[model samples]
Target: MSRNIPLLDLQKEFEMLKPELMPALEEVLSSARFIMGPQLDELNDHIQSLLGVKHHIPCANGTDALLIALKALDIQPGDEVITTPFTFVATAETIAFAGAVPVFTDIRSDTCLMDPNLIEERITEKTKAIIPVHLFGQMVPMEPVMTIAKKYGLKVIEDTAQAIGATQHGCFAGTIGDIGTISYFPSKNLGAYGDAGGIVTNNDSLAETCALIANHGQAHKYEHHLIGLNSRMDSLQAAILNVKIKYLEEWNILRAEKAAWYHKYLDPSVETPVTVPGNTHIYHQYTIKVDQRDALKEYLAGQGIATAVHYPIPLNEQPAIAALKLHGFPTPVAAKTAQRVLSLPMNQYLSEEDIRYVADAVNSFLNTKKSQSFQNSPTGSSV
Candidate 1:
């Protein structure tokens, strides 16, 4: 029997772009400078220009980008960084990696992004920074989050992992915070062939620090400045990104169009996704909440449709979170969201027929109360 549709078809993406990609790969192979080469520099310059930021430091991956940003801000042991538990593990894991504690801030139930209003309540003497994840490509309430951050003198790191080209209130998603991190994972909107990540910042001091940290703490050859990790972006990956970056806007537009279709065609029995005001989303995952998430997912799978869960367990409920055990985190919204949210197969390459098939399957499943066979897996790779 033939299989159901896969979540994303990277092979198809490559096939469509092979003409442009082949030459770039050949150029990189000819240069033979694999690390921190001209290709990487060119890609960084392109990202900086596109995002309207001063510095765009390319790194090994998104997780490392966040780690470097935290390190640059001088986050250390005993410092508390406020973040949402409804996002990918990397959002909080980077804070922990920087020897800081990730204080779980709940999300807005509607947008599933961090609730800026709740951030102040979590801030304490130990709170040194706030990392608001732009979850599912929707911008967080940044104007309010920034106001709270400025009042408290805390660094803000926007985790734009799933929202590279997304915009809000006429400004880009990654440009709103002091420092922003973006992933070029294979499945992202502007993903590369393998792992790649970039950090954007307007602060000169922070940019210098991030660059140094990603380069083994080296200011010069054999001259170590600070303790750091080896997290440089490779030239080959940069070449791949250079080719894809040009199409990000168009591809994201396609994703947005597909999302609109889903929103219009979703079963009346199911609750649809919520879009925040003044946000122009890229629709990274096109996620939605429903009454019977697992059942719906399975039903879709049986009908040759694929679905995923952005997160099934809130951060507070995770085994890694028990160690911190903060008093009264109150993740009621995050916890409830974890159980009901589901992500349909969303990609720039998806067709109108594909969207209709998935929607029809969903409506059918919801009506008959019959579920298809599928694993209720978490969306984030680390999870």
Candidate 2:
């Protein structure tokens, strides 16, 4: 069977927003201001207003956003920043890029967020910050994390790349931390047409520093202050994002509705995603846990269903970063969870029929596996 359900359908999303997208692009082209244009300023203003943050600095991409946030905080060589191992490499890569060591912490078994209970044990005299990723569109348990940070005077940077509109107990995901970073990658909840990102902070000085860092540390047109990277969002991407921002809340609601549909139809034998209490999950990816994950993924694919592993290998185990020589962190929970987690098709554009079909396919695969296991038992012949 040909593959039917996909992980995401950006084409359908574009079709829904074409009416506004075309005019926005045309406006940018006519103005001829592609860099640092009016659209960029408008997007920054809109993001600040939406998140109720004091400053919103747009950057080239999500990775750059994290790097800029770290630079703004003055995290440097010999400093250690604690973060979860079960996340996209960018979460830890940016820390190392900022000339700091990324100390790994295990995630909670249920929520898949960094375990706050294990954090204090990892802090040392060189610890400067803690980066808690809002994984799979749910906010990390910030209350406990924040308390721990306060006790040790460590700064917090919320990696909100996946959880743009998520909230916890009335606090927005990114806004709760000292510095918050968002990604506008094509797949994110609030994605632009291409690579783009933003940095958010309530602190006036940090905000100024972030803007300077993203703009090559330029105090003026020709004068350079601090060494920085060239990371800026172009006018076209900013214009596209401006149009999409108006529909972000509604799309998130649709994603939630689809998640509910998945919950209603999927077999109870498999594990479904658990929303952290007091959190509004945007369902960037409707991930589930199941035994025999690799075999089940192949089974689903053969039945025309698409599945993905968000992170098959934890950051600490990736060979590419072996030069960091990180070791001795107890991350049993992260290591175990990485082997079993599977992401099903999830997006605002999915239909009820699409959700039902995917769930039915998964159920069929699991049922077959169970039958095979029972038949292979030693006592099967007697029965």
Candidate 3:
């Protein structure tokens, strides 16, 4: 059997960092202080410096990061938070978790981030914040979102889970908003060995508030300030993250190079991905628009090239959120995007040969159009 191409190859990344990573892990293990330790503090400082933000609060996962941000801002039940539908459910899920209603906004057909133009129509007295997710490692056009937030007295929480290092013009994704959340989940650009996430902010008070909330609402040991969740990043994950942080810029540069290679090589008929105007893309997933996404995905699998759909369902249509009773909301773009989006193999570890192989596999799959076989044997292996 031939080697299968992985959607993301974390083992290759791990091998690259083993020399420095192992020692860090050893030190954390020796300390035995798993929760809030020196490793966590170091990783927080490293992320803060890299993103040029004043405060970094380490959390257990990205979802908790957003929830903490919303909690810190005093967003409550019945408050409306505007967000795009064409992203991971966590963006909206966290809004609901914050006890606020997620007002679904349409996305830009090209960029797939929140359509800043459509925001005003959704605003109402209940509106408290706008979460413009930096989807697929590209910064959501922050200037317009910020302007609208300023005009309406709305808070902006940047869902930067997929765009830790991505920027628009000269501004970084997480820093542009009042607060931002990033995931260091195994698949992220700056991934940890396991699940990990962080919140970044320029405001000192907001940072302290989120940190307190993440630690079971305690500002000090055994003292509960408010009802909060326990969501602290483990020392082991932080130790791994601290080692990886040093290589982030170099890895992001390689990812950019691979994205360029894909652009140069992938078939033009495939509707290759496009970046938001004036925004830098970190190519987290390298998603392309394909008319026959399911068929092509199957064909690629047959060729040992793994592929995935970043999101196959729009958030508004999710069964969990249907009770909100949102309808006739210009969801055509989101629906179409769900059917058409296909993520190709993307990681800093992919070599020139791997890039060409995946590109060729996609173009070949498109040319062959194996519709019947795909329909007949649609396996659930796009992991």
Flag the better candidate by TM-score, 1 or 2: 2
lDDT of each: 0.86, 0.91, 0.87
Compute the lDDT for candidate 2.
0.91
Candidate 1 lDDT by residue in tens digits, 1-383: 32467688889889999999999999889988888789988997899888888989999999999999988988888799999999888888878777889898888888898888899999898899999898888788799989998999999999999998888888887787889999999888889888989999999999999999999889999899988889998899999999989999998899899998987787766676788888888888888898789978877778777889999998778887767665547889999999999989888777887888788877877766533222233433334
Superposed model 2: Cα runs more than 4 Å off: 1-3
Worst 10 residues of 1 by lDDT: 372-381
Tell me which of candidates 1 and 2 scores higher on lDDT.
Answer: 2
Highest lDDT scorer: 2
CA error at residue 338 for candidate 1, angstroms:
0.6
Candidate 2 C-alpha lDDT tens digits along 335-357: 99999999999988788988988
Query: If ranked by lDDT, best first, what sequence of candidates would result?
Result: 2, 3, 1
Candidate 3 has its poorest 10 consecutive residues by lDDT at 374-383
Residue-level lDDT tens digits of model 3 in 1-383: 34488888888877878899899888988988888889987987798888889999999999989999999999989899999999899988988877799998888778787889999999999999999999998987888898999999999999999998888887788998889999999889998878888999999989889999999989788999988898999999999998888888888888899999998889888777788888888888889998888988888888788889989999998987787665437678998999999998888878888888888888877766655456556462331
RMSD of 1: 6.3
